[model samples]
Target: MKILVVFVVMVLFCDCVMTKECTNTPTQLSSHTYRYALLNSKNKTLKQEVLTLSSHDHDHLTPTDDSAWASLLPRKVLKQEDEFSWMMMYRQMKNNNGGSGKVRDSGSFLNEVFLGDVRLDSDSIHGQAQQTNLEYLMLLDGDNLVWSFRKTAGLPTPGVAYGGWESPNQELRGHFVGHYLSATAMMWASTGNDTLKKKMTAVVSALGECQEKMGTGYLSAFPSEFFDRFEAVQPVWAPYYTIHKIMAGLVDQYVFAGNDQALKMVTQMADYFYKRVQNVITKYTIERHWRSLNEETGGMNDVMYRLYTITGNANHLLLAHLFDKPCFLGLLAIKADELSGFHANTHIPIVVGAQRRYEVTGDPLYKEIGTFFMETVNSSHS
Candidate 1:
């Protein structure tokens, strides 16, 4: 009887993971994932009925009812600015006079200009949409990215070896590969284009194979040694960042494609990382890892949050918070913005995690820091 019961449960589990096809086109998508992310102020209000799912899962909260408290933003800081490539690309707004000018305050006003007052579905984007901009983005992002790494772009170093493409900017290759994977994942989720879906599936497959070949359970378009250096407490570049992109892409695939292999691929990567980098250290472990850690590896825990949501694996969620770099965040704890000339994308998203945490934990300070950082970076960086 027990054996029969186990078999019945197995059959049901298999049924849940079945490979479902996504047929939603761009036109059809206006109602689904597009609408999910493109929610207007009204829809956002409806989403507020919520409470915490966990530290990692989304909080169903929204700013409503006069924001639960009155607040004032520092007026002077609103005009301070910082520069980043992508945010600058979007700040082409012109006032009545056509005299050329840049609206200086990037970090302060960015939130209002982009996430708020300016809508993602604005006619401005549709009217000026050119293939070149999107194509450039497509080329500029992802692991083993062909366009930027093509001999025309540069020469092959690591992951760009696929299809004989080369990239002079070796540092750009890893993160771009990861970003392209994410973009492809987003493109797949948004459009359900069968051709692109197939292409992305193949890309994940090749990446998974490369990961397996290294025997370390981690995978990248670059040398496996990056992970080794990271785990061994040696100096390294953005391993956690690249891993986050790849895992986020996989989770996105599971969300959109319901792909089994993609799910497995991400699980393996997480397992490797969780063991090597996350709390596997001894209490009296070396000083190098203890001190330099907050500098390089922070987002491993954030990705675990998403993976936990996807696989219902509690461990993934637990591990995501393990690398909480409190010092940089201590600045957030105090609402500081001496945050110039450092890693922009890394810290920005980490602040976002704090925002999510506030909603789940009902911690007001998290709200204060997240909102402040978001406002600061939006105005200054964007």
Candidate 2:
């Protein structure tokens, strides 16, 4: 009896070890470092440039303020990527607005504080963020942000926004606003601020209600039937793209907001995909109609990897690979450089998944190919 008991204990120990190996928790380097690196690399913010990105008039813009916009990013990534994106935006804004150093400075300040490089002047900071309308994406100003959340909450308001973005402004308000949710939430949690955190929490709650109302554990700014249509291959708007926005937003909420509900929300959506996608053949056929319309299924992998991140489910990861669709997989598997004419944003997130695949599976080739794709896209497309 003693021998048998000892053997059982040994087996349990081995199983525990193997389970740990399979879990997708960051075992070594932080999962967040690369993102901050990208932000810094975005605009060329020097690592040593720690100047306070503030003006005398900016800090008091809002009364009784509290938020973390200062420390959400991973330490290695905080300085560089945050600045780089600002540099990129500054260049673009310069081209459009003409000689607005202050505009670029505001972007720089926001990124710096967001990643924890400096404290923002609460009073002037809001004005600065609002003044640079294109970049800051202040969620507080318009009825649109609240309405967007309410619409997704199923409040039956005609003016209710959907997709958590002002649906009327896809390019300006949709995916980009999601990035703000993520960044803002991250900033708040890392720094212990309740305002931004509360704001994001409300949005998350509204979206949760929407998911509940749909009664299928799925939520989005778009209609629920979008997935069915995608499976049916019927004509529809970019369902996968919209899914990416929500997926990324949810994942961001988990990462930035530290909300257990956010994690559950993401997992439920993944479970929904796992439950629904396999036998649905018609979606592909419906998708083919886009050859005439020029609107192809873009941003599929973004959602898949987001699912993979939350559930660490092999099915979610495999589904992302499945999204290689008829167009890219065969060629991408072979490392084709001929992928030039594709929409830049649509495909880059796919490569991001390939990179994640490499991370979890220890597949070096996925890393190589994903890096190559990123290099080509950043250099040529942007």
Candidate 3:
């Protein structure tokens, strides 16, 4: 009886192994076999389900008719082949247990599932990053950040180093604080580190306090006199350029980190900016004094467009329109090469603004202008 039972167990094990082997048996594909398979598969529902699941966009799937199946099947098979290749590569990566393998075909799914876990193990680059972020955090002083705003508003100055660019006699002063706030906010979001969050909160709160003290919906490291200098075409550094950076930083903080204070500060700043620019500068003035538009304004128009999207305020949209440099955009819209002597970086932002304007207004003219500018730049430069 013991021998029979042992023999029976061995037979059962062999049968199970054979069944597994049979299920996984690989078939050799010839032209005939491939064609036969495609012809034999008549289940439209099953094919539709497979296609629906594989597509990233289900609602707006390409080729929405039954005719798509004929052409789509070959593409679907190719996609499966690509996926299999990636899986084989991923398996090799797992087996090697090293971060040196290359995945040639990466998509949203592959990035999230496989490559997301892949990272350098104790490399010098990562070590330096820790030191760099630490040093950056140490350099940021919240009190000094609001020094200029405080001074202008009759509040006490904390008397720190005034930051790098925020120092006196520097036109670009206070620009660094905006960039720093933006960087810290991003760092906190990426790492979920409480220290970065604390720094961001401190900087934003200080900015808000300065805005309140000024009592004019104005918040800047410099006084509003800079705009007067800008309007007079005198030797004042790019005030709008610096302000755009700060506004963009604040907007980023709000969008990425859900910082409400940052949003409120930028909104108030936008209001002050609109009233000042609208009162002083006109459409005719912009067209006539085209050289004034050549200054490094950063993407002020882009930021205003974004603000309009967030608030649904017509004022923000109007401000965005006002920032359009007609001289630059006008020439580019006609496919003319007016960018010969222009600063590439300065004008690139304006093109970016044009693109944003196109998105917001759905104006084909803005789209044409942006496309022509981009194509011209790429063709000439590259």
* Best model number under lDDT: 3
> Model 2 segments beyond 4 Å from truth?
1-143, 146-165, 168-177, 189-192, 281-303, 306-310, 375-382
lDDT, candidate 1, 190-241, per-residue tens: 4445766676776666665566556666665555566665555343445676
Which candidate achieves the best TM-score against the true structure? 3
User: Which 10 successive residues of model 1 have the least lDDT summed?
Assistant: 20-29
lDDT of 1: 0.47
Computed on alpha carbons, the lDDT of every model, listed in order, comes to 0.47, 0.47, 0.62
Please rank every candidate by lDDT, starting with the best: 3, 2, 1
**Residue 269 shift from truth in candidate 2, angstroms:** 1.3
Candidate 3 residue-wise lDDT, 39-65, digit = tens? 234655543442233221111112222
| Error of model 1, residue 23, in angstroms | 51
What order do you get sorting by TM-score, best first? Answer: 3, 2, 1
Clashing pairs in 3: 165-173, 166-174
